[model samples]
Target: MKRIGIMVVAAFIGGAAAIGGYKLLEPKGGDALSFQEQQNVLFASNPKVASTGAVDFVEAAASVSPAVVHIKTSYTGNSSNQRGGSPFDMFEDFFGGGGRGMQRAPRAASGSGVILTPDGYIVTNNHVVDKADKIEVILSDRRKVSAKVIGKDPNTDLALIKVEATNLPVVKMGNSDNVQIGEWVLAVGFPLDLQTTVTAGIISAKARSIGILGRSQQQPTEEEYEEYQRTGKMPTNNSIESYIQTDAAINPGNSGGALVNANGELIGINAAIASQTGTNVGYGFAIPVNLAKKILDDFRKYGAVKRGYIGVTFAALDADEAEKLKIDDITGLYVTDVVPGSGAEAAGLRKGDIIKKVGGATIYDSPDLQEKIGRMSPGDKVQLTYLRDGQLKNTNVTLKGENSVASTLKPAVAKNTNKATIDKLGASFAPASAQLKTRYRVQNGVVVTGIEQGKLFDSWEIPKGVLITSINGKPVNSSKDVEDALPATRNGMTRISGVGPEGAFTFNIN
Candidate 1:
């Protein structure tokens, strides 16, 4: 009887030990794991290993395709008036559209998205879901669900959306700052209205700005222009276009898809393709995931992008730009003007100062500065290195919210009068003739008689012969009129309204 009791006790103790071991060693529930940990766990369980010797993308493609979803969007009313579709869809007429002003039909568009969270958070392009009436998400397991836009930012061409589902596969977000040129990567999406497809390519470039986002937004109007002149407030487009350029075969339906590294980590959200034929033509652009993370978090928290501004107007300085601006320095950004009540003003950043660096990264071009600032929010502090009078100085600038008021940033205008103004314009002006006025449909104006190659007008691409109807809200029929209207406002911004080949337009020069 004593031997029997001892055996039973020993068995019970062994059973308890085994149960404890299982509880401690087993993987945690999906909800309890971080994205990186979850992704690591997933790949660990898979038997196939990605080959590193000869550029095999089998493992990455398989891991990413499941998280990349097919997104179909429906637009009500006229398709011409709506804004949902590929950015290249504007070129549809050049490709397949019968002609302009043809009978329009309601449009149904399809794109792609990457699942960022298991509970249905997804990241896509703003153009993919902007003004979409209904969004339907199709999962890899052949399950269909509805999705709604949480927030959409046209500046960065990014949108955060959510679906009403759980246990969805997610793509791990990777550090795009570490993505090197010529590195092999994969593009995963549903392209050409086909099933999930994967393509491989190399990173062609980084910090590329194609100016697509600016073209996609509504053009400035005369009223907005007039308001800017009257109030000394510049009309802000704030379009951020820093993209990771790749040679991946991204097509029309691939917008908002995943551009993943060899580790199957999400690095970019594929946005645009540089093709006039409305198809892939070797160049494809993706919004870097580094810039998208802040935007996505803002969407989840604030339901809008809380974009911060440095409160300065700057031009990326190259050899040609420096020559146009009549500056000696060929690198860094030349500060043209500073906005009043801006953080830049408080930080004592003046016009003529060249911004050399942001944080510690060198500012080689607009994208370098734009992308870094684009990732930060209002009230965030940033360190800037600038060159002033041949002296390099540093300052900490606390970014201001769009509506926050602070210091007064004086405009960068020459103390000298009209001669400096005309020189700054870099274009000779003449009184508009009756024929020119009639052609441009303007009441009174001056013509861009001639443009100096290395001047502001030429650099801005303001073509010769375009009618300049007004300057700083004053009707300019002659050069004398323009000279008198120069620097009219205390804020020191010059607003120009005119008719160009593209029709009525307005712009501000600081």
Candidate 2:
């Protein structure tokens, strides 16, 4: 019995020593079991966790969805339907078009808009409500109200419309100039006729010009001219697309919708999609809210876009061009020509000069400069920085009005001659002289003598002395013919053919 008790004691001693050794060899925190328990206790008491990199767009979506509205437009049938089969024919058929007689029901189309004010001032794409006989805004609560277009600026593709509603939801505008790449954003719109949809994406790029907006002094390619002839769809005229490009899913009905940041602030107006299928293909473009805001302000104050022009024609500087011009950096716009008696010329900006900055913002390309000047009004002074002969120079330029030169040069016309107006065509025309017709080899045409600063003529780069020979295949012998061919209330596309210094050319104006 003594020996057995001694053996049991020895065994207990050995087990205790083994346990103590294990404890001594364990990690600093604790034994495996105790470490896990400690972790559980810590977690329970603290409860803080690391982020998983997931974004929650619910707040943004909710906040912006209420301010976005569904815009439905109706178009009446008349000579505007000259192209018997129309693009909206299918839509009209689906929505029930006008009756079999001349008094047909108005064809309907739908898009989206953003409410800008509480008393019912709304902002939307020009294409959305352009030429519509009636526009109706359907709010988030499904209350439909008739709206009227107050003003439109085709250069920026923005329109201001008003409704008779009170206490409406308005979106908080954000500074798009501060929007960063890869930042989270939400596109709120009625895409594909679906009820308001909110899609999230990150900004893919900035200061993108897709050539959808025709460049100044840019001649259309053969393919573009043929495509317009075949489709009867005009390219965007005086279109400004210094767009904030994104990968968001923007479809047909997304036009004129709101592009909100993660804070639910409006940063852009969803406009065009770069898709071959006429649907979202991961690439979408929006007019920056800053540009849109400028347009809105001008519309409110001047009843039109009070645009400021520097009167310089330029092109993007390439490496070769930069080298040829002895420029070390190809970061500025290469000034090919400067208009005489204009702000640029007055400021001593000459051809071969490279504009480096305007109003302190770095000028990266033509669109950047265009956007900067476009946002300012006549008589506004801008600080200009340019590289002249490889030397950096600075000057201040006071801008002039669109018709400043015309007002100075042209002779006073009789009341009868002034009877004809160009309407929204944004150009002034006169009967071409015999010498101009002989020089251009055109028998009959009208001369585009002057243009508005930010209008169709300027956007199309229709320079003065160019002869407009035809419109929509109809011969234009005088200003009246041109005016008649392009009626003020006409809708859809227009084919404008003219001859310039570059020879015969055509423009498809929308």
Clashes by residue pair, model 1: none
lDDT of 1 by residue, 1-510 (tens): 999999888767664554444344435432344344444443333333232233768878887889999999887766665532333343342244323334443467788999986678888888788777899999999899999999998788788888988767778777899888888888999889999999989999999987666654435445543443344332346788788999989987888999988888788999887766678879889999989888887887778988888988778999999999888999999997676668998999999999999998999899999999998999999999999999999999999876563113102111112332377788767665432343344568875656778777888888755668988899987778888887684477778888764577787877
Best by the TM-score measure: 1
- What lDDT score is found at residue 450 in candidate 1? 63
List ranges where model 1 is wrong by over 4 Å: 1-54, 83-105, 221-235, 405-510
Q: How accurate locally is residue 330 in candidate 1, as Cα lDDT from 0 to 100?
A: 96
Poorest 10 consecutive residues by lDDT, candidate 1: 407-416
Question: For candidate 1, what is the total of clashing residue pairs?
Answer: 0
* Pairs of residues clashing in candidate 2: 98-105
Name the runs in model 2 displaced over 4 angstroms.
Answer: 1-54, 79-106, 215-238, 320-329, 405-510
Q: What is candidate 1's local distance difference test score?
A: 0.75
